[model samples]
Target: MLALDNIETFRGPAKILHGISMKIEEGEVVAIVGRNGAGKITTMESIIGLLRVKSGQISFRGENITRMSAHSIARRGIGFSPGDCGLFSSLSVQENLEIGRWHADPKRIDKMADGDTLEKRVYSVFPEIEGFKRRNSLKLSGGQRKMVAISRAMYLCPSLLLIDEAFEGLAPVVISRFRDALKKIKEMGITLLMAESNFSNASLVADRVYVLDRGEVLYEGKPKDAMNDPRVKKILQG
Candidate 1:
């Protein structure tokens, strides 16, 4: 559902992603794993058009979206959930989700008319959210806030979801909840490309893994195989 071909990204003169290439098939849960400075987030930003591409191409569903703006790409069926969980602190749970549904194109909204299903599924995955639906976002626990952020993104029902660091700094139980939610999302036929620093948590959820080191894709394979690689071990344990 998503493909990146030799894509390069730079912040001013400092190159962050060095000829990165990867593909995510429909309904697949793909994880990009890396240490602190591996450019994993930069790669994701490039794909979602948050960063300018210095070279190479990005394609989604057979269309070249290399030059598309972030808003345009999102309208084209890509949902992004950054590490910060981009939520409006003042908005209630349902109100926050409504913002995600406010895309420019009316046709795109019609195409993604699964908001009811999305709400039901998200609330099912996070039953706690249902109780807190009327609460302010800033009043939520860290994990609960994260759920709100993810649910808002999923409210649009994008074909491909780019998730950055969903499990960072959370308790194990919360991480488990998030992992289960991700699996449910995959079962619903939406593709996922996630950037995670936690190897064990990622291994539990990812079907395939790509290991990046120093802004380069050093390894890519099945999650089990990638987890066993010496390089991957070094990077994760170092």
Candidate 2:
């Protein structure tokens, strides 16, 4: 549902993505895999319009979004969950989720089935967060904060979700939970574009993997194939 064609992005005076190109089909979980400083997050920011691209084009569901503002792109059914779990420190978990709801396009909400609501969709993937709704966001543990971030993104009722470093720094058990949650999200028909520094972690849920190095695509194919490729192995081992 998303396509980036020979896109180049810059952060300040330095170019971060050098003609990066990739594609995500509807309902697929695609992973941008690379080591630190490999431009995975840059790619995410470019697609979300957080960082404007200097060249090339980005299209979602067949419409060009290269020049759209972040809010406009979001309104077109894209949601982002940043790596740092960008929740308001002073707000309760419930309030953080409510803010996401406020950004939802009313016309999209009206199109949902009679009984479906944004809360239901979010809770479906992260039921644990509901129990701590009244808790201050800053008081939650790391895993809880991550869940809230993803849940808040779900609140946008997006067709495409861009999650940067979904499993970074989490304990193995927490990672497993997120994997299951992501699978549930895919079953619900939402397309996921995840940026992960660890190839193994990305492979756990990604249908297709793109290995990026130095702001360029090094490999693009099935996770299994990438695992066995000698060049990919070299990058993974480091």
Candidate 3:
């Protein structure tokens, strides 16, 4: 569903991603694992057009979108849920969801007219969010805020999703809830590329894993294989 070929990005003269290449198939969950400043987030930003590409190409659904703006990329069926969650503190849960609704394609809306199905599905995966539907988003806990952020992204019904640090700063129970929700998202045919620091939690949902270090893709393979690699172990430990 998405492919990045020899992508390179730089901050002024300093290079970040060095010819990074990867592909994510439809309905597959791919994890990008790395330590701080390893360029995992930079790679994602390049894919979603937050950062301009210095070289290489990015393609989505057979179309080259190397220079597309973030909004254009998003309109082309990619939804991004960043680590910060990007919630409007003043908006109620229903109001926040309404923003996502505006971004949905007309064809998708026609196919799923009820719209309630999306809300129900989100609430099903995040039962805690249902109770907070009428509450202000700013009033919720960290995990609950993350749920709202993810739900808003899902409401767009995008073909592909780029998630950053979904497991960060939350309790284990909330992480488990996110894992289940991600599985459900895969079942619904949304391809995912998640950048996470927590390898164990990422492995639970990722079909494949890519290991990056010092702005390079050091390893790429099955999660189990990457997990067992001595280099991976060394990097994680260091």
Error of 1 at 217 (Å): 0.6
Per-residue lDDT tens digits of candidate 2, residues 1-238? 8999999999999999999999899999999999999999999999999999999999999999999999999988899999999999999999999887899888888987899888888888899987999999999988899999999888888899999999998999889999999999999888999999888899999999999999999999999999688878999887
Off by over 4 Å in 1: 104-116
lDDT of 1 by residue, 1-238 (tens): 8889999899889999889999888888999999878998999889889899999999999999999999889888888888988788878887998877776345654655455466676777677788898898888888888888777777766888888998997998778878888988887777889999987878888999899998888889888887578888888888
Candidate 2 TM-score, true structure as reference: 0.97
Candidate that would win on lDDT: 2
As a TM-score, model 1 comes out at 0.93
For model 1, how many clashes? 0
Indicate the worst ten consecutive residues by lDDT in candidate 2: 104-113
Task: Put down candidate 3 lDDT per residue, 1-238, tens digits, no spaces.
Answer: 8999999999788899989999888889999999988899999999889999999999999999999998888777788888888889889988998787788775765665465477776777677877888899889888888888888887876788889999999888778878989998887777989999888878989999999998888889898888578999999767
The C-alpha RMSD in Å for every predicted model, in order, reads: 2.0, 1.0, 1.8
Find the candidate with the highest TM-score and give its number.
Answer: 2
The TM-scores, one per candidate, come to 0.93, 0.97, 0.93
Off by over 4 Å in 2: none
